[model samples]
Target: MPPFDPLRRRLPGGLRAEHALALTVLALVGIAEGQRLGPGGRTTPALVASWLLAMAVCGALLLRQRHPVAVGWCTVVGTGTYYLLSTVDGPLVLVPIAALYGLASSGRLQAAVTMAAVMVIGVGAGALAGTGDVNGTAVFMLTGWLIAVVALGAMWHGRMAYAEEEAALRATQERLRIARELHDVVGHNMSMINIQASAALHRLEKDPAQAESALAAIKAGSREGLRELRRTLGVLRQVDEGAPTAPTAGLARLEELIASSALAEMTVTVKKSGAHDLLPATVDLAAYRIVQESLTNAAKHSGARHVVIRLHRDDAQLRLSIEDDGHGAPPGPAGHGASGIAGMTERARALGGALTAAPRPQGGFAVHAELPLSDNKTATERSTR
Candidate 1:
């Protein structure tokens, strides 16, 4: 067995080094007082009572982190009892300041303020009522220390709150990304299957071969859709089961996307006119999703028979356009029947890119995306690391 580390050991009453140090200071103060006043200097009862109260206050510091308010109250009571019996020229004054710091840092701002006010008044009262050599200078110094502790603790609390907010924002963004993925996968496949089912019914009596082919396409699309869904969900549950994994869809699979259109009953032509190799992973995935959503929208809403997908690249940017010879708009919002346009826009914007989807002046509808290749590549590479 390895040697034990004292630092890792849990001490009784949760007394870590800081608490132990506080207790030590209290013990030293008691000794100093005993020596200074000597055995027959003051009433024995008052001296003993003062020492006991100081001990109790130091002991209460053990639970400061978990129960700051309670510890603060105990320290207050102990300080008052000690000051009433003796004077404030001792280490017992330090206890209330430490308690106030703990209280404020633990998110008890109001309680800390109240304790500060009460301690100030108690110190003044002690000076006026006690029989020791207490004076106004001691009271002023102690009050200033109390204020500084509370200020530092409040600053610490503010920093913690900011960190919590940042974490929550990141969580919200991740959830939205997941939602977009689910929508793209399920929405596109369902649209294609719906069209293929209709086509199969129409051709059943006239052309058996074509109808059977349509059914086969629907089955293939459904299976592929389920596979993609599982892959996407794997990000949430990273535990490996006995399932085959595949790389995410990118521009290289443009042909496969076109072939899958056997379910759509529409011609989807692909054209590439740029350097397609060595694209960043994130850019590739976003491009695939934009095309997928565009095709799905066309298959569902456009009464046209042909769609075109074009990919172009330059020194600084990768551009893509999906145009269909379909009815321009369906008398509603731009994203008429679905959030496909919004999802596409969000994807492009995330990678420092821009996307525009509008009706063509002469004929159909067009979706255009201009993605900054340099920015996307640099950002994606950094994130992968």
Candidate 2:
């Protein structure tokens, strides 16, 4: 037994057209044979009645796909009566053939079995009593064709069910991925922003300038965090319509980040000595995020007020360095992140770049990442035009 598939179901009008065509052909052939039965029998009321009944049975197939079990049983019963009255040939048999498979595929094994039994009993009994087409090769051939149709319908039902299940599984996995990314982005930023906002609110009356600036930074950080989250969700959309093709936070936005760092209580410097060219969008965005996260970490965890951020580019690569004059080394995984060094490392690696953070023997923490330019050469990656 197979379940119904809404997506795979054929339209009602199409199914009706198919059934009507089959029955029309069957009826024409049947009427031709009856006309050939000689003048005495051709116009008999009993003969005419049988022909009309058989024609009605053939047309019954219009309901086959929708009510397969009911139609199949009705076909079996009507076919038996037509056979008894000697006019069940031609398109009349199509009703049973068309409806039988749909019955078997409608997720009702018991009903399918009952209909199958009726068809077999009706046909077998009629053939035995009337000496009909049972002994002919065509009988076996037609039975084989009908059975194949039933089997094919069952296969379709199974395949459709499997496809739906696979689609649902994929949707669940996507939801989980979105959940994880949102949690990582919001959890980290909200905690820091909340603390800063609470402090600013408490000091609003005492130090108006410091409180106002703190509140402003909180608002900016929160807005940026929301923007990043929205971008992540956008990736899950089915269509690319109206969505940004590339990330917005690239190297060009570095100055605003430096200002945020200064507000977060870190002394930040930006030094670019070489000519600046447009970087590959992904690389530029990664660079900015690396710098931003590092500065945030310094503000939160490091005792350092002084941080140096240098973006230097050669013909082949761009090197970004962030060093904090903070308390010794970060203790655990998030050590760099208390200021955001660990987050910076992750951002670098995600863009096919490499990151290294080591304790400065003289003082704070130093973070470095080397990103390859599209026109540049590196020992590991040689980019081509």
lDDT of each residue in 1-385, candidate 1, tens digit only? 2432222222223346657667776887677668646566864666787777888888887767667688889988888777667743677767777678767765778999999999888878868876456678878987888888889888777766665655565566678788889999999888888888998999999998999999999999899889889888876774566454866788878777787764576799888897756678888889999998888777787665689899898887889999989886742564554488888888888788999988788777889998877766333333434
The residue ranges of model 2 lying beyond 4 angstroms of the native Cα positions read 1-4, 7-19, 22-30, 33-42, 136-139, 233-241, 245-385
TM-score attained by model 1: 0.79
Ten residues in sequence with the least summed lDDT for candidate 2: 376-385
TM for every model, in the order presented, reads 0.79, 0.59
TM-score of candidate 2 on Cα atoms, chains taken together:
0.59
Q: Say which candidate scores most in TM-score.
A: 1
Candidate 2 lDDT, 262-320, residue by residue in tens: 66566788888675778887678668767665665566656678999888887777899
lDDT of 2: 0.65
Work out candidate 1's RMSD over C-alphas. 6.3
**Over 4 Å off, model 1:** 1-43, 55-74, 87-90, 117-144, 238-244, 331-336, 376-385
